[model samples]
Target: MIRSTLFFALALTSFSALSQSTLQDSTHIDLQPVSVKVYFAPQSLMSITSSTQVVGPKTLTAQGSQTLVSALNTVPGIRMEERSPGSYRLAMRGSLIRSPFGIRNTKIYVDDFALTDAGGNTYLNLLDPLGIQSIHVLKGPDGSLFGANSGGVIRIQPKGFDALENQVQLQVTGGSYGLFQEQLSVQRKVSDRYQFSFDHSFLRSDGYRENTALNKKTLQTSHQWQVSKIQQLRLFALYTDLKYNTPGGLTLSQYEANPRAARPAAGKIPGAAEQQAGIYNKTLFGGLSNALQLTESLSHHIALYGSYTDFKNPFITNFEKRIERNLGVRTYFSYAKPEAAMPWQMQLGYEGALGWNKIDNYDNLAGVAGKQQAMDNLDNRQWNLFYRAQVELLKNWNLEGSLGLNKNSIHYKQRFPEVNNPTGDIKFDAVWMPRMATSYQLNRLMALRASIAKGYSAPTLAEVRSSNRSINTDLAAERGTNYEIGYKFKTANNRFIADLAAYTYTMKDGIVRALDENGAEFFSNAGEMKQRGLELGTWLTLLEPRNFGFVRELTVQAALAYNHYRFGDYRVANKDYSKNKITAVPDWVNTNVVHLEFPQKLTLHLFHNYTSSLPLDDGNTVFAKKYNVLQAKLNWNTTLTKNTAINLFFGADNIFNEKYSLGNDINAFGGRYFNAAPMRNYYAGVRFDLK
Candidate 1:
């Protein structure tokens, strides 16, 4: 009761301040009138490509999300996985294969930085959510913009300078459950011809699990200059430093005892007296890109980026020591002109990445080093091409299509100090993958889209080329094809937008079973399977613009999906294997949200989500229970002085305290498991933003 009273007191104080705040005149970011219409971008946001969706910063902030998994859960046809602190495993378009390390199937990037595996099954930590301006999720055959590994592509864009403006802002926030975050940003117009901008954020969370902790810091910058009336030059750079603790998985009994508990120390036995015995992991990466615009009718963008990843599990003797580096480049060109049939535009591009990996394995007993085990040195390279054109068929009709081709190569060199194995020396192999898609618009308010494309995932360095004791070289790249159709509609006031889509994905000669027999798992023709689904979504303003309406602003939105899957032809026991239902494909998933704004300074929000039961695996093993979660929050903006303003927030997640998991891997090792979700909790914060 006392805690509640204190909380409300703070809310009331801030509410009063917000009512009298004078900063509203200077607090806007986009420089548009509060009453102006705003619509999310296509190709970047929803169903234009059929099973994909885009999330913008405004939506993110209104949701008041804390983790990537939670932030993305509001989307349809997308599944988010949070196995441990700062680690994620995302499966899209019905993909369910696990790689030797880090995430599998889905490709994740932040400003073109490939957060590949550093140690075992690793990737980049989710950066500060408050600093993000938008995210694009490309589903099925986005290889045209991404690569062939592109079952799905997640892209992020930070805030940037607009057509006009020089603005600077800084914000700091502190909340419950040991949460803290701060962001600083600057955007300056050198002239009508030049602009500069930069953003940085720092965040920390103690987390619900005892050992599930996260710490992250990030920096992003952009520079643009107009060298000629029709030409422009742009430069981009980013840096991230993250450290997190890996909470070893637990058995059902252990979970029942404590869901928010981890191995006393990563991999340490219980009742064994020890200090600071846990697996500590950290990663750092940086990148840069440059783009140039040519004539008004022709523009080309070229980018070069690099990343370095390193990780160690010193506590686990004989565990491989790993280090990797990747360098890549990309170029894109676009042209637009009037034609007899209609106005048309063309786009073409290509990108490549080269990666180097090193791993050292040593023999050891009982956490004590013994003899040298295995050493590996390898290189990985990739290249791809993209082409597309869009044309207006009539005043209200439009057509667009694209094609993409990608190639991947891997090479290995091994030098054992004491032992030598047969299989020759210094070898290499390359694989090629291709894809394509097209769409047609019926009118300015509606469109029809369809796509059929191919994609592939090459064997990672740890899978094909690493000499680590558990490295597997007998595996082949996973191959698959994707198909989809979609429709979209929007309101002229930009207050409402809706989309519907359907898709099917099939994987032939799929790659499965990893690290078995000490990473000696051999590849087979494997099984052919298919996943089919439908997604429906919408964003709308329940209350019209105050300038032309009778009430305050109210926004309501929802996303929903339905899915079905089946495993097709394959050899299970040497003979032709037959029918079986694919597992883990939930029949339904939904997200609904409502937000309200009053005349003075208060915003009220509510959100809800639901997911149906799903099988544990492709074989239709055990089924997980269906579940629902609810969240609500209130934000008050106020000022205590002419120059000082205070913003306060109060929120709760999973208000019903539902217990569920998004991704669980029980067969990982010795009857252990990872959960998909955590229990609910309460949170509140105070924010101070200034010039």
Candidate 2:
């Protein structure tokens, strides 16, 4: 099977090159640098004082990745892992200690709307890359603008809304393990002042392991209206329905015996397959944003958003269901004067959210609900106010400062098993965070920057009222201060670009996850932990398009990360774990991409990813070994007519067929921690566009 797949890829590559060479004339494509827009401010990448990265549409289209992890692995200081077809987890700067199944400690936004809820949980997996135009990532903690996060911030912009043109697109893809997907999109400009777009997608996959199938569908619509010359309104709506089966983790012995088998029944508990454990979720989200120019030097922006979620899960132990509703509002004002002797900018913002949840649990009688076990009602609220100021101190130097106040509170009430009436309310003290940064431009091609910021992360609703049918009212919010310095450089001809950053952070009241004997998950506060890391990214153009024999353009991009994370002070069951390596954090991670473009609109991309060994438990007695994977993709684009185009692509992953675990269950009982990733996979896709 592997040989046949390789042969097919080679044949397609050869055919694309031959056809391109015969059909098109030799023409040079312009290679120019682009500017980055961070926090609604547009500037050159080399001039930005913060550590950030941008992934553009060209890269996304060339790679044709199915998940965000595949497209974002090129960014330094970021890690994404998938346990199953639809389960995703992300970590930044070695902050995965608190995250086990979803995105936490990170703020996420789409356009002007927030994707994170009041309880600090972000549903990033609900978005499909087909509708995304670009992604901007801020590397370290920045609680000045974004609220209550220790990791960082991510902003995603949709395609049609930014293009402002009339177009239609269709795409289809099929790959190994019964993977298939279809997408359709339409955008139209009704008038000079109004624009609208709609997108729909369907995806399904029969995963590598038993009971690991997935089905997902999504619909999204967006509209923009220029009310007047200096006023505008934007609206967005989204709907997603997803279902995915879960294959529980296996012990090392089980993994070696059969990596494809589901978790087996043990003692009084049933097996994962027997219980038909899986997740079913239906969600709807919408937002409205408005911007007004109060004066030549002042502007105001406001956004109102809401979301609803219906979630159902059938597990080995119980059948759980939840109905969740959330509403939020965000407003900000900015004043800028660039014409003055010393340019200055200032901003003030307020953000607030309210959430309500109704949860019910019942006995899982072979995937069917039996007797009612428990019922609960939860209410969560969060609010934050922030202020920022920036000034040009000298011709080549700048200074920035920011401050924020954050408040969080949660209330819980139990309805079932009311005899004892387990009810509680917890409120955290308001926190004040401050940040300062400075940048000095050494000529036009190079810059030096440094920053210090305070960070805070509150426990999620799931962590407080856990799946183990227990409420942890004593859990406290984690606090930390991060220090960082960075250097950025670019050549005058834009042939080379490089960025390097070093940072350290010490956190108190850290949260960690653990599994009980029956495989139930719970969280506890680890006393303290310290993290230090270095990140480096570089892009070099070895050769530009010319009369080169067959290669039109050749470029190489690479990112490297080095992490040193350890427990500063921690103890469990009278045993000290101080100085032990942090769980699930690798010592080193590196990624490289090589791009080669041919004359006939044909391109080839080679990718390499490497990760060092990491500990799986707090005791540091078990570890996951290191692994390396190589992948390649080939793409060809043909302009059939003046207004129509077609694209063909093929790719292969895990070309070496190495067996490794992509995600692990931390501190699991009975040593059932391994979840094996797929060995080797191949995919092919095609796209059609009309204008």
Candidate 3:
């Protein structure tokens, strides 16, 4: 009763504030200094050569997904695969291919933090929907801004400024699969050069399947102080704590039986070598960041970031419990000037990680986690440099170019009886990725654009994961080149925008997973791969934000994409395998959203998402059926007093409950996919503010 009452009162306060507060329009048709201040790097977005997209924070709020990756699905030409309940694989512009378990071809960044996975893929462990301010995707060799990313990059920007001169906001949510969340934020800035703010949240989920539950907590703080009459410094820090369970991958047959099912084979380790087992996982990660400015146009930024991560499963399918650990660091730099027509900003950085991995084999027959051996240890290091310049050429024409260089070093020590060989090596390779693009602004509302670049990815330790339990690393770096042409049209003053781009890429030396000499699946650098596609996306505002009338405020967005994959010759098991669609990649991915605001504090939203069927694995032998999802929501605000108002909102996912699944267990051993999508679910929430 107490909790409910507190929430009721809190909701009223926030609702009242919302009623009187003003909502900014991101669609304002002006390229003013204030408008550009928000983007960490605006040049990257305005230039045609880089091929970039920025998903506004308001859009994220409307979607209400738990993670940013979930919202990115609406972006065209980017492919995302749900490797696990909380884990996903991202590939941009046909660059995603087979990579080690912990590594990915694309790099992910949060401000100055590296945040990449232990295996090299960007880590989503700390991602939360409400904490983000905006998301930017850089396609093709972004070596100029982010280091070591050959395919592309995902950049997450956290919310900086908040409404209310001084206030406290709190919220709680409960949903399907025993999911629950608690969020709190305290901020104030009445006077310039003297202000502070903080936000924190806790989240937990029972999960959709066995052993998939998760509990997470995060906190962020920012403080600004004037050091001198003309200089100021801002300091910030962020922390994330996560504890969860991994149920392990399921077979096609097993998945078909139930989406929430778990393998009976993983319990061995905890049971003294039982085949099927599970474990609770824990992780602690955070970073310390800073920004300094002597003048409005001349400022400096720096960050020191690190993370301690461990995954422990003492008992399971192959053998018993296996533990892996990793810790790493990242550093960054930035520079920009608005006065110069050819504004430029360059960044340099590095990351180093030391990890430990060990496993055992109980019953080597089924290859179900049955291995026991102490592999020596692993030490990994990487370094990178990138630069990009936005040059305003002739009238209404702009050009941007970027370049990057990166290298890696790794070492592995043998610990078990069958694998006593230890090895280490340093690989020095420079990647040259440049994007030359130009946009011809025909008028205040129209423009033409085009650009091209190259990309490359290095092999990871897991690719060579050959031991008694798992496979060893034995693959080389994969490299490719990208080609794209596009056009942009905007209404006078930039109130409405539409973008279309067509891209094609040819790549060789693709690194992929395949059965090696041991007849076990592992990473291998293969022959060649290709992908071509077209992307059409648009954004429009029918009415300004917070408008109090039917159609007084509304925004609509839509996109359509088509990707084609071609291969000269494909071979699996030394036999010819060619001309097959690349696995897990959909031929079509599309989405549309409509948001409406009305008088008396009423809002309605409708959204739809669609994706073509995808393959279970790289071979494309097994596939997931195509499907579309629809959702609708309604919110009402009521003012109880001058300082308070109440808002009630309700929504549902998969309105039809149309049963589907992305699971592919059928193609395995000549089988078929068993489950594809989770069952339908409902959601409701209330948020409160105090001052």
Candidate 4:
């Protein structure tokens, strides 16, 4: 399999080289400056002091990524995994020890509106890749500005409503494992001051493992109105209906024997196939945002958002149902002066969220609800106030600082099997976080930076009221401090760029997940843990457009990360795990991408990824094997006429056919840790645009 994959890659490279040799030269295309808005204020990527990455439409289209994991896997100090279709978890400069199913300890936002609930859970899978125009990722703890996150922040920006002309587009894709997708989009310029855009997508797949199937539909719309010369109003809405089956994890022996088999029946518990374990979700979300230019050098912005969700899950032991509602508001004020000798900027903001949930549990009898077991009502609230300032200390030096105050609380009331202490509440104390950073530009091509920051993260509601039907009143919030230094460099012509960073953090009261005999999950606070790592990223332009025959452009990008994480002081069941390697955190990760572009808008991409083996459990008694994967993509775009265009794309993943676990069940019972990823897959798609 490895040999075949290598041969295929070589053939593609050779073919592209031959074509380049026979073609004529074209005009050179200069790289544009990339800007991001999530960093307190809009700034170029190279000017940020923190370790950050930005992905725009060009990169997204080149990769032909179907999920967020594929789009972000090449980023340094970050890892995204999919245990099964519609199930994902993300880890940034840390380990996934606390996240068993969804994203945790991370803050997510969409154009100044919060995507994370008050309970600190983010449903990132609900958004379709086509609807997003760009994504910004801030690596490491950033609680000082984003609030209540130890794994950093992610801000997604959707396609804008403004359009130079009215247009419509349609796209269709199909691939292995019965994969199919369809998308439709429309943009309209209703008037000089009003514009809107709408998008809808449908996707389905018959997965590789038994009981693993996915079906999802998404609808999104955005509208913008220029209320006045100095004011603007924007509205955003989204709806999603998603359903997917869970194949469950398999033991190593079971995986070797039949990787496609579902989890077998255990004693009295039913098998995954019999129970039809899966999740069903229907959600509606909307937001209203406004920007007002209060004065020549001052601005004000505010946003109001709300969401409703109906969710259900049927598992081997039980069936669960939840109805949730969330409401939030965010407001900010900013002042800036760029023309003065000592230019400065200041921003102050407040964000708050309220959530209410009604949960019910019942016995699962062959994929059906049998007898009622428990019911509860949960209320959660969180608020944060933040202030940030940036000033120019000298012609080539800058100083930035931020501070935030956060408060979170939760209340629970039991309705079924009522007993003593049926109602309880937990309120965490208000926490303060502060950050200070400095950047020194030695020259136009290089910069040096350093920072120190504090971080805090509260336990999610799911961790307090666990799947085992137990309330963990002893759980506490996690707190830590991080220190870092970084260096950035870019060539004069922007032909080469490099970023390097190193950091270390020590955290107390670290949350960890555990499973019981029946496969029910729960959480507990570990004593302490420490993490240290180095991250490096570089991009080199090997061939310039007009200077290299038919090759419009050729670039190579690479990222490498090294992590050393361990338990400082921890014990489970009277056994000390201190000095043990952190669970599910690879010691080293490397990713490389090769991009080639030719005349007539033809593009080709090759990707290679490697991950080192690491421990799978707290005790370090089990480990997952390391693996490498190679992928390739090709795309061609053409203009049929002045008002029509077409694009075609084809891609293949895991071309080596290596059998590896995309996501592992950490600290699983009965050694059921392996969930095999797809071996080899291929996809092709075409799109049409009309104006």
Candidate 5:
């Protein structure tokens, strides 16, 4: 399969080159670079001092619309995994070590609102891929601006906010494993001062593994009104109902025997299928943002957001239910002096959040809630005061500095068993995080940058109140410092672009995951971790749009990441694991993609991924094998009329059918680590658009 795919790719490249040579005199197709708002300000890629990457709409649509896993993995230094149809795990650098299922240690924002709750957990799975317009990833840690985080930061931009014309779109899709999806979107601009958009999506699938099924529905709306010449108001709301079966992880022997089998009964324990292990999450989120231009050089922006979640899980050992509510506010003020001899800008901001959760655990009797086991109520509050300043000191030199003071505390009360019913509160001392960066423009097409930042992450509510039903007040937060240098280059014609970055991060009191005898999970602080890595990305536009040839456009993009992650002075129980390889982090990861556009409004996309083997346990006794994957997609677009259009697409994933685990349960109690991914699958879809 690899040989055939590579041969086909080569043949297409040769054809594209020949076709491009014939149309050398054709009209030039300008490929414009996009600006990013990662730092609360718009700037070109090369002008930023941090290591960041932006995934645009074209890249997001290149893969299937069912999930963002494949598209996000294309970015260097980032990894996204899907254990099932609707379950997602994400990592920046090597942060996946602490995440067993959902997203943690990372701060996430949807537009100007904080998507991450006060408990330091993000429900990334609740957002549908059809509603996402783009994703911006800040690779390392930058707590100086966003807040407390040791892993990194992610900013998600929803669709319809950029629509300037009235439009309606409808799409339907069907795929292997009984997969089906439908989506609808409507956008309208009422005069020149107001605009609104609505999007809805539904997806379902009978997954490949036994007892693994998924169903999800999502609704999102965005509205913007220019209240006056100096003020604007924006409103956003989202609702999602997501449910997916958890097949549970398999032991190596069990995985080898039957990769498609759900966890089987061991001893007196029930199997996943028998227990009907699964997750049900229903969430509603809303936010209101206001931007004001008080003066020519001063502006103010503020956002208030709230969310409610009803979460349920039925597992082999227990049934868990949670009712969670969260409220937050983010506000900032900016002042710029662009016309001054030495241009400079500054921002002052504050972010605060409050969350309340009521958790209940009961015995799982054949997928039903039985006798009550444990119950707890938790309240969490966090706040950050941050300031950032930017200055153009010299002709082509830029300097930036930022600082943030953060405070976190949690109050918990147990209400179930008398022995565990302890009323207590944990308050962390306030910490100061600072960052400094500098960038120099060597020329119009080349730039050099360097930065140093501090990182700190408090324990999440789940980690504090673990599956053991005990409050771990002694668990300390993770702290780290990162130093980085980067270089970027792009051709004047925008035909070639490349970014290279290297960083060394040293973290102490690192949090690690462990499982109890019952296969329940918990967290603890380890000694320290030392991580060093290099990332490189390049893009080449071989041919642009042409009117006369079969090959209208051709582009090639590739990303590579190399990691050297190791434990420092780490000892657990009777084992001294100093200098051991970090669990769940590979040494080498790479992705290559090819895109080709042809006549008849047809397009083809090919993707390949390679990941090296890595340790599965801190002791370095077990390892997950290396793997490669291949995927492809084809699309045909045509105009039906002056105000209407249609698009048809077909796609396939895991074309090589390689056996691998998309997510691994590291440091599992019984070595039940492997979560087998699906084999080859195919999907087809059609979309209709009215303008």
Candidate 6:
């Protein structure tokens, strides 16, 4: 695999070199300045003193539209994995030790709404790729403004805010393994003050392995209205019905025998196929945001949102049902004095959430719910107050600082033959998080930055009440501090762009996952961890765009992440595993992308990923092998009429047919850790746009 990856890298380098020579006299790449909103305000990328990456439409379209795993992996310091067709897991600047299924320890936002609930869980899989316009990733802990999170933050911008034209679009797609998808979208502008967009999509697939099928439907809409010259209102809504099968993990011997087979019956336990092991989720979410400019230099913004979810899971061990509801509000005030001798800005904000969860667990009798085993009702509340300020001095130096105070508590009542009828509220002590950063513009093409921040994350509801059917009141929250330095550079002609960053994070009382003899999972606090890493990104434009030339444009981009993570002061049950490598964290990862545009409006996109091996257990007794994956796509776009356009695209994934496990079950009791990913697959699609 390493040899193959090296050869592929060298080939691409040679091709890029040839193209650069051939187009030596062509105009330099005409790149544009980029901006981000991680600070609740727009800031130039070149001047921000933080590690951030942005992904736009071109990056999303380079791969298949089925999932965001491949596209998101192209960014350094990020890892996205899929266990099956619809199950996803995300990690940034940290190991995936605490999360076995969903997203945790990270904050996420869509438009003006917080997707991460009060329980610290995000349903990222329920979102359709077509509904997303762009993504901005903030690496490392940023709890000063975004609340409790130790991993990172992801902000998603929905589709409607990108344009203001009235239009209609339809798309149809089909692929191997009985995959089918359809999407429809419409946007209308009633007047200059109001506009709205609506989108609907359906997707289904017969997965590569048995008992791994998927079906999903989505509906989404967004509206923007300028009520007055100094006021604006925005509303967003989304609904998704998603269902997917879960193929249980396999032992080494079972995996070697037949990688495509689902987990078979072990001893007297039932198999996944017989028990109908899968997930069924139905959710509805809506939010309204208002912005009012009270004075020339003062403004206020507020958002109100609510969501409900009906979730069900039938596994070999038990059948679980949950009814969850969440409500939240976010409001902030800002003051700016840019025209003063010394420009400055200040913002103050508050975010809070209230959540209720009713959970029931029952025996699984041939895909049916049987005798109740456990039941619990939990009420959770969390809130954060934050303040940020920025100042400019000496015409080239910028200084910034922020702080947040957070508090969380949960109360629960147990039913169904419960020993404890009611449990007192478990309250976590208030914590303070602070951040300081500085940036200096050395020249027109170079910048230098440094920052230090603190992060804190409380235990989620899932961790508090795990599958072991016990409430672990002793579980402690994790805390960490990160120090980072970065540099940014670009050429005068905008043909080359490069960014480099290095950081070290020290965390105490880190949460880790464990399993019982029956395969039920639990969580506990470990001793400590020391994580150090470096990230690099480079983009070069070989050929500029020209309508009269045969070769319209060509560009190549590469990103790399290197990690040296290790356990410190760690000891568990007579085991002294200190100084061992962290579990499920690779030593290095690299991704590359190439885009070429030809005459006749034809384009080709190529993607490659190489990941190094990593340990699967805390003791470093088992390891997963390294692997490489390659994908490609070809698209042809043309104008069918003066008011209409058509686009046709075909793509293939895993072009080399590498056998690997996308998501591994950590610390399994019986060495059932391997979940095989799909082999080579192909897909084709057509789209039409009407204006």
- What are the RMSD figures for all models against the true structure? 7.5, 5.0, 8.0, 3.6, 2.6, 2.1
How does candidate 1 score on lDDT? Answer: 0.58
Q: Pick the candidate with the highest lDDT.
A: 5
For model 4, the superposed segments whose C-alpha errors exceed 4 Å read 1-32, 161-166, 190-192, 547-550
Q: How would you encode candidate 5's per-residue C-alpha lDDT over 1-691 as one tens digit per residue?
A: 3543453355446445644554344444423345678887787787889878888778888988889988898889988888888989988876577774478778999999899998988999988877887888888888888888877888988875655558898999999999999999888898678998889999999998988899999999988998899998989999999999999889999999999998888898889999999999999999999999999999999999999999999988999999999999999999999888889999999999999999999999988999999999999999999999999998688999999999999999988876846898999989999999999999989999999999899999989987776679999988889999999987666666778999999999988988876778888998799999999887777777776688888877777889999999999889998999988899988888888999999999998888888888999999988888889999999999999999999999999898998788889878898989899999999999999
- In angstroms, the error of model 5 at 516 is 1.8
Better of 1 and 4 by lDDT: 4
Better of 3 and 4 by lDDT: 4
Indicate the TM-score of model 1. Answer: 0.81
Query: All candidates' TM-scores?
Result: 0.81, 0.94, 0.82, 0.94, 0.96, 0.96
> What is the TM-score (0 to 1) of candidate 4?
0.94
What is the C-alpha local distance difference test score of each model?
0.58, 0.83, 0.58, 0.83, 0.87, 0.86
Question: Residue 565 of model 5: what lDDT?
Answer: 95
Query: What local lDDT does model 1 show for residue 401?
Result: 67
Give the alpha carbon lDDT tens digit for every residue of 1-691 in model 2. 2332343244334434433443333332222235667655675666567888887765666564567776677888988877778878888775565573477788888887888988777878788778787888887888777888888888888765655668898999999889999988888998988898888999899888888999999999889998998999999999999898888889999999999888889999998899888889899999999999999999999999999999888988999898999999989999999888998889899999999988899999988988999899889999989998888888788888989899999999999987877777889999998889988889888999999999898899888877787778999998999999999876655656778999999988989988888777899999898989999887765555665568877766777888999999899989999999989899888877778989788889887778888999999999987878788999899999999999899989888898988778889899989988888999999988899
Q: lDDT of candidate 5? A: 0.87
Tens digits of per-residue lDDT, candidate 3, 90-147, equal 6676534453333366787665566774446444656566666667776665544555
Instruction: For residues 1-691, write the lDDT of model 1, one tens digit per residue.
Output: 2322332243334434444544223222221111211111124232143455667665677655456665576677676655655566566655444443345566666554454432113363535665566676666645555565646666665555335346555666665557777777777788887887787878777766665566777787767677776555656665666655545555566666777766433343331012221233444455555445566577766666666666544223344466777777767787877555587778788777777777666653433445667776666767777777766666544466666676666565555554563233222234344444455656555767777766666655554543235334556566677777788766444445667888887876565442232212233335676667888776665454353333365666677778776667755666553455555557777777767777557888877777777755444545566778777888889976665567788877778788876556522334344453556766676665443
- Residue pairs in candidate 4 whose N, alpha carbon or C atoms collide under 3 angstroms: none
RMSD of 6: 2.1
lDDT of 6 by residue, 262-377 (tens): 88888998889999999999999989999999998999999999899999988888998999999999899999988889889999999999999999999988678999999988
Q: List the residue pairs that clash in candidate 2.
A: none
CA lDDT of 222 in candidate 1? 68
Q: Which stretches of candidate 2 lie over 4 Å from their true place?
A: 1-33, 546-548
